[model samples]
Target: MAVRDPAIDHLLELLAPLGAATARRMFGGWGVYLDGEIVVLFARGVAYAKTDALTRADFAAAGSAPFVFESRGRTVETSYWSLPEAALDSSEALRPWAQLALAAARRKPVARKARSGEDRRG
Candidate 1:
């Protein structure tokens, strides 16, 4: 049997109030989703919430740092930011941040141009 990481369990518990959040193994960690939209990512024992222009400043003000990784010798910064220390206290404490994450996740994605030879028609 696979041993479940306690961190994953804890994150789910904290997110329970938000919705039926689920986690899937990914990138040597977990990707947490709510209502089919990914809102959080758990990596190296840290929980990162999705952020957008609207909420990035809030996270920054809370002293949260963005999720970063190295790829092909280049640093990649993602739109996810670590949950603030205060939010780790409980679901109630985490709710507002979680809500912001969910809102960012639910935002409409930008449209991308079709690749060469790809169908652009309906």
Candidate 2:
């Protein structure tokens, strides 16, 4: 069995007020979900909240950086932004940002395309 990270446990505890937040291994780190929707991505011990145009400015104003990574020799910036340092202190501090992330997650459009070897037409 794989060992759990204490940092992740602490993060989950801090997010308890936001509902039953859970973490799963993802992209070499972890993805934090609430209500079956992914609202945060935890990588390198940093938590990033989902963001859209509506909340991106708030994250930027907080001096939070967008999640960026190199893929296929290209740098890619994701819609996820780091949660403000203050938010890590407690659930109360993180509530507003977490809610914003949940809102952004719900606002995201779902993909309608079928993958390879799959057909949507019946």
Q: Find the candidate with the highest TM-score and give its number.
A: 2
Model 1, C-alpha of 21: deviation from truth (Å): 1.1
For model 1, residues 14-70, the per-residue Cα lDDT tens digits are 888878989899999899998788999989899999999999999999999999999
Task: Write down the TM-score for model 1.
Answer: 0.88
Question: Residue 56 CA error for candidate 1 (Å)?
Answer: 0.5
In candidate 1, which residue ranges exceed 4 Å CA deviation?
Answer: 108-122
Q: List the residue pairs that clash in candidate 1.
A: none
Q: What is the TM-score of each predicted model, taking all chains together?
A: 0.88, 0.89
